[model samples]
Target: MNNLEESKTFVASLESLEPMRDFVSQTGSNAGLNKKQIYGLCIAVDEIATNIILYGYQNSGIDNGLINIHTIFEKENFTVILEDSSTPFNPLETKIPDENELGLPLEERKIGGLGILMAKESVDEFRYEYKDGKNFNIFSVRPNDD
Candidate 1:
C-alpha cells in the first residue's frame, strides 16, 4: 500500500492518452502489480478516455474539455479515477453489448457501448458517477498471484 495518490489532468484529446498510459504503468508497478495487470489497467483507462475524447464534448459547446486521471495504490488493490468536465454520463448504466455484437467488425457493429463494455470487463470493479457537472469513473484492479 502506498500513501501517495498520483494524479494528472490533461486536455481531452488522443494525444494525452500516452501520458495517462505511462502514469498507469508506473503506478501499477509501484503498487506491486505484474506486467499483465498493468497492461489491463492501461487498456481499461484508454478505452474510457477514448470515449471521453470522442463523445463527451459533443454538443457541449466546449471546444476543448479537460479530464483528470487519478491513481490510488493500496494494499493488494490499485484504483484509477477518471474525471471529465463534460456532460453527465453514467457509463455503468449502459447495457453490455452482446457477444455477437462484440464479434462483429467495427463497420458492421453498433457504435456505442462496446468500448465501455471492454473497459468494464478489464477491471475488477467499474463504477461511474456524476457530480457537480463532472463525470467520474472509478476502476479498481487487484492482481492475483495464483
Candidate 2:
C-alpha cells in the first residue's frame, strides 16, 4: 500500500472556497488522481464548505467560524476530512428529495437538499460525526486506473 500524504487549510468565508478548492485539487493531483477524480473531490469539498458559509453560523452571528480540511492521499484511495467549529449540524442527515419528486416543477419542489445528495453520490464513502462541539465530515474516493 502506498503511504498517505495530507494537507490542511482553514476556511472562514465564502471567498475562501476557491482557495480551498485549489488546495484540494493540487493535493489530489499530487496524489496522482486523474481529472475526473480531482473534479469530484472539488465538488464535494465546495458543497460542504458552502453549507457552512450559508447556514453554520447564521444564528450565532459568528462570521469567523473555521473550516478545517484535511486531505489524505493513500496508495489505494484519497480521503478528505472536513471539520468546522460551527453549530453541530450534520449534512449526512440532510434528507434527500424523492426521485419521483424531481420531475415536479421547480416552484412546486422543496429547496436545499441537493448538496448532500450530490456529495453522497459522487464520493465512494461519506461519513459524519459530532464531537467536541464540532461538525466532522469525512469523504473518500478511490483512484481510477482506466
Candidate 3:
C-alpha cells in the first residue's frame, strides 16, 4: 500500500451505489488504469458493495449502516478496500458457482453465488475478512502495460 489517503464513507443502501462506482472509476483513472481495467474494478467493487448493502444491512434490519471505502496505490497494483459494520458473513465461504451449475437454466440455478463469482473474476485479486466487528472486502488489480 503506497498512498492510503484516498478514502470515503457511504450509507449502506442502494442509493449509494452510483457514487461508489464513480469513486472507483475516478480512483482507477487517477491510478493510470485503462478503461477496461477501470470498468472491471468498478464492477467488482459494485457487486460486493451491493451485497453488503442488501444482505448485510437492509435484510439484516440494521438501519443506518455505513460502508467505508479506501484506495491504496502500490507500485504494481491498485487496491480498493470496503469496510462495513454488518454481521459476520464471509462471502468467500459461500460456494462459488461452478461451470456445471452455471450451465443450468436460470430458474434451476442458484442465485446467490453468481455475483460473487463475477466480482472475483473481474479483478486480479479479491479477498474478504471479518475482524473487529467489521467486514472487509478487498479488490486489487494490475495496470496493463501500454
Steric overlap count per candidate: 0, 0, 0
Model 2 per-residue lDDT tens digits across residues 7-64:
5767568888999989888988888788888888888888988888778865667876
**lDDT (0 to 1) per candidate:** 0.83, 0.82, 0.88
Q: Which ten residues in a row have the lowest lDDT in candidate 1?
A: 55-64
lDDT of 1 by residue, 1-146 (tens): 34658888888888989998998899878878888778878888999888788778745666778889999876667899999988787778878788888888988988777778878777888888888878999998885552
lDDT of 3 by residue, 69-104 (tens): 999887887899999999887888889989999899
- Order the numbered candidates by lDDT, best leading: 3, 1, 2
Deviation in angstroms for 56 in model 3?
Answer: 0.7
Poorest stretch of ten by lDDT in candidate 3: 1-10
For all predictions, the C-alpha RMSD in Å is 2.3, 1.8, 2.0
